[model samples]
Target chain A: MKNYLENINKAFESRARLGIMSVLMVEEKVDFNTLKDTLQLTDGNLASHLRALEEAEYLRVEKQFVGRKPQTTYYASPAGREAFKSHLDALEQLILNNRQKD
Target chain B: MKNYLENINKAFESRARLGIMSVLMVEEKVDFNTLKDTLQLTDGNLASHLRALEEAEYLRVEKQFVGRKPQTTYYASPAGREAFKSHLDALEQLILNNRQKD
Candidate 1:
């Protein structure tokens, strides 16, 4: 159990962060507005969680301008992708362990 | 994603709590000492988490004495089992979503 739990990343514990990563997992790149709308998070809430993931190096941020407007985009880093995958694997193991007990 | 993430119980957000629930999901009843040792948590740490789970009504505690020594045991309440099952289902859905994306 410890072995299985160890891989579950604390970074993705927040549902917002989990939602962010889940989106990034399927999409190559997501802009700030798209993510905010998809996760239904306010700007501040989304920024903070995104910053947390960036600090963990699980996510990378790119700021660019589309015409006159500055747009921020997020991408799950290589490390982040690996870590999230391990976390999901751990979750799967825990679920499987329960079923086997049944 | 929102639908899947919504079912993850906040009570199991902590790794310690997750470990405790995972153990209880498999075993009918576990004593305090065994839970503490199995999760490798300090007495206070384990007690605090146990208290949180108890407050959430996810666990029921039974106390008695073996000779002069006191014993405390834990069992996952029926509600807890259902909640945890739902949480695990949400996790499985998240994992499957990722896999399907791949």
Candidate 2:
């Protein structure tokens, strides 16, 4: 069994990063603008976090044009998905362990 | 209904803080030593995070003498408990919503 403390992904430590993962988990693919609006993050803020996730290989990015306007899209990689699930599992495990002490 | 994105507590943003709340939620009260050991955090690191949580009113601290030595204990305040639960609920909602897209 994975220890709860050790299983948490530090990459998801920020609320912004965590929120991004949450949206990606369901949507599978999200545009930079949409993600920024949904998470209410600034352009630079969202970009930095996205870059971090990308560097960690937790997210995949694509740049495409819509009607000649450039659009950036993001998707959670397979490793990203597993890391997120494990993080959620760790959270649940911690909660359950605490509940047992009640 | 609380908007899933806005409901997440930024106060629980850190892995250490989240772990602290997790331990406090079930145990009702945990000494600083136990928390430090359980989370494997450095003394300064734990103190900084604990101070942050306490400042946010998510944790209560009590300093007293255990035998001849001074011991500090921590507990999640009512607001803290509710906040953590809300954060957890938001995470679950995000996950469930993602599952539906599958």
Candidate 3:
């Protein structure tokens, strides 16, 4: 049987943004440097993408002081979580369809 | 509860490519012109993307003659279907997480 692909299509929005979402999806909150290292993204590039997601309200950012330096952490919002789940379901169906074909 | 976001992140791959996958997910088979119109993509642009997808083995193209003209139909291959499904699953989780926040 053929699987539906709407969520798969949505997956094509932006690679960096997607990565950020993935990282944020698992951890309750992640530090900026850790995210950068994990995703191997340059500071500017990561900041730009994070700004976009923040603007879309998919993520929330918190800034604070850690010792003498500044720290920024990110977390996924509830809406973002729901969107991801639905997208996952659609993707799973697509995979199932392909497996059946094989 | 906090939701995961890997699938949501995967949704940012490519808008047009995602759209193509979305349409194919529901339809058993789709024609080139129909896909072009549905996506509102230029002939060359659509053809280029289709070529990439076909190359990736995500889609299959069948060319035939309809009446006196040529017709091309496309379908998602098994691998392509699986990839698309996994991608969708990631995206759905992202959305779900966001929704819960509200």
Candidate 4:
């Protein structure tokens, strides 16, 4: 019997991190303010989750200037996208497998 | 914006507990030994995860004897089923929302 649970990644366990990845998965790039607003997270709280994902090498960050203001943006790296897809696939499997029994 | 991430329960964050719930959701009653084998979890590991779910009122346990051996069986509480369904729905929403953008 295959253990589908093994495919659930701990890195994406937190809702905050999950939200970040969910947004990044679809959008090519999301700025700090946009992400913070979308997820409705405090600066500190969002920053911490972003740092955790970055440390896991699941996301890449970019800093640049928009006009006179400094802006930070995030992107889902190839590795991150691959891992997130696998995690999603595992969740789908868990749900589908149970549904079949019902 | 309705944050689908908000529907993701912290209780199901651990893969072990998730596996336990996934199994319990479908099966009416599962013995401790059967759960341990299905999830490929050690006794201590499975016990701890079971305790966590029990604490959350997500699962119910019944203990009795069959022949000369003591047997423990588990069932997913109504709350557990509801919570797990919400989590699965949130994951499905996340995946579907992103897919539409592709």
Q: After superposition, how far is residue B101 of candidate 1 from its true place, in Å?
A: 0.6
**What is the descending lDDT order?**
1, 4, 2, 3
Question: After superposition, which runs of candidate 4 have C-alpha atoms over 4 Å from their true positions?
Answer: A66-69, B66-69
* Best of the candidates, DockQ: 1
Scored by CA lDDT, what does every candidate get?
0.90, 0.84, 0.71, 0.87
lDDT of 1 at B2: 79
Model 2 DockQ (Cα-based):
0.44
Steric clashes per prediction: 0, 1, 53, 0
Query: In candidate 3 chain B, what residue range of length 10 has the lowest lDDT sum?
Result: B1-10
Write model 1 residue lDDT over A54-79, tens digit each, in one string.
Answer: 99999999999999999999999999
lDDT string, candidate 2, B1-102, tens digits? 127867778888778887888888878799998999988899999999999999999999999997999999999999998888888777667556655666
TM for candidate 3 is 0.61
Quick one: best lDDT, which candidate? 1
Tell me which residue pairs clash in candidate 2. A26-B98
lDDT for position A38 in model 4: 93
lDDT of 2 at B64: 96
**What's the iRMSD of model 4?**
2.1
Q: What lDDT is reached at residue A57 by model 4?
A: 94
Looking at model 2, residue B79 earns an lDDT score of 93
B1-102 in candidate 1: lDDT tens per residue?
778878777888877888999899888999999999899999999999999999999999999998999999999999998888888888788889988987
TM-score (C-alpha) between model 2 and the true structure:
0.87
| Model 3 C-alpha lDDT versus the unseen true structure | 0.71
Candidate with best TM-score = 1
Give TM-scores for every candidate, taking all chains together and pairing residue i with residue i: 0.93, 0.87, 0.61, 0.88
